[model samples]
Target: MSDGITKIKEEFDKKVAEIKALMKNPQQDTGLLSNSVDFRDKNLIYSNSDGVFTSSKDKIENYPAKGYPYKRGVKLSFSADGTTELEVEAGGGDDLYGICTDIDEFTGMATVVPITNNFTGYLTFKKNGNGVNPGDKLHFNAQGELEKNGGNDKSVNAIALSKVHKLTEELSIVLASVFGNRALKGN
Candidate 1:
């Protein structure tokens, strides 16, 4: 069973490579164009700035799931072992992180969007007693979720976009930025 699965995967990867090659070339042959429509419709094919063609969508990445079943919208960080492996814990000091968008249980991969400088997007955050108002400086709480009440030790640097009641499980959207020093300092 495993051998059959591996064969299927290999074939699929080969076809994907061919499709990527066709998309990269300036003049694509009609034959290669036949199977390319499906991928393009999903916005999965593109020629990147570095002149390499990849199927990865903009701002989305597939990383190996160190801990399987990462919940949708959970904050993620690169494990200490490598950059491509993802874990649910908040990274310590200067480490970059992303929000979980989806999880592929079959492949054990987690889809995430890396929070970069000036990135404006939605992230799941645990609400504090203040209930997270706009302009509140957010830092990673102990569980790797966002909270405005965090102390000086943790710094993820996300700002609340929409207000969430303290009764809610988490805040749904935030403006994540890596620039400047908007980090929360403990009182």
Candidate 2:
């Protein structure tokens, strides 16, 4: 079976190389016109330093009008479970640290719930006039779980175990398939 698969792959590679070589130099149609104007009238008018001419007003209107201005700002949020690390940053300012549940100055309190069994959070920054932009890091702690300092660590452990259980089942199937092929070859 391995030999057959290798032979098929070699033939496929050869065919692809042949097709690529055929497409290298395509024949051009002589009937098609080569000479054409690359610049548009609107682009030519906008490029002029002197500005656009007005017929009735007897004045030149500058490219950019006065009304347009740029506006900008920043915001951050975070979450985690079990034993997870959180990082916080204010624009041109100090970095802050805390657990998933613990609140920071930017995100006042825990409002959003965890989507998965794991914890999740986001840091969002925005320009006032435009839409929000994300910070460098957006993270979810897959191995971590929500935990109280003392009690209820067992409950968090149980949730983490459940996620591990699902992953183990998937990995087992993949390993079985890989090893099964080796066993068959040995036979």
Which candidate ranks first by TM-score, i.e. highest? 1
Question: What would the per-residue lDDT of candidate 1 be over residues 93-182, giving only the tens digit for each residue?
Answer: 344465454567798666655554234444545554356677666765444455664565555466666675343554444444333335
Candidate 2: tens digits of C-alpha lDDT, residues 1-187: 9999999999999998898776543344333434336573333332222221212212211111111110000113233343333322222111111112222234342221112222222222121112211211111112122211123222121111111112232121000000100111100
Which pairs of residues collide in model 1? none
C-alpha-based local distance difference test score of model 1: 0.51
lDDT of each: 0.51, 0.23
What CA RMSD would you report for each candidate? 14.9, 26.9
Model 2 error, position 178 (Å): 80
- Please list the residue runs of candidate 2 whose C-alpha ends up more than 4 Å from where it truly belongs after superposition: 24-187
Q: Look at candidate 2 and give me any clashing residue pairs.
A: 81-144, 81-145, 82-145
Q: Indicate the worst ten consecutive residues by lDDT in candidate 1.
A: 46-55
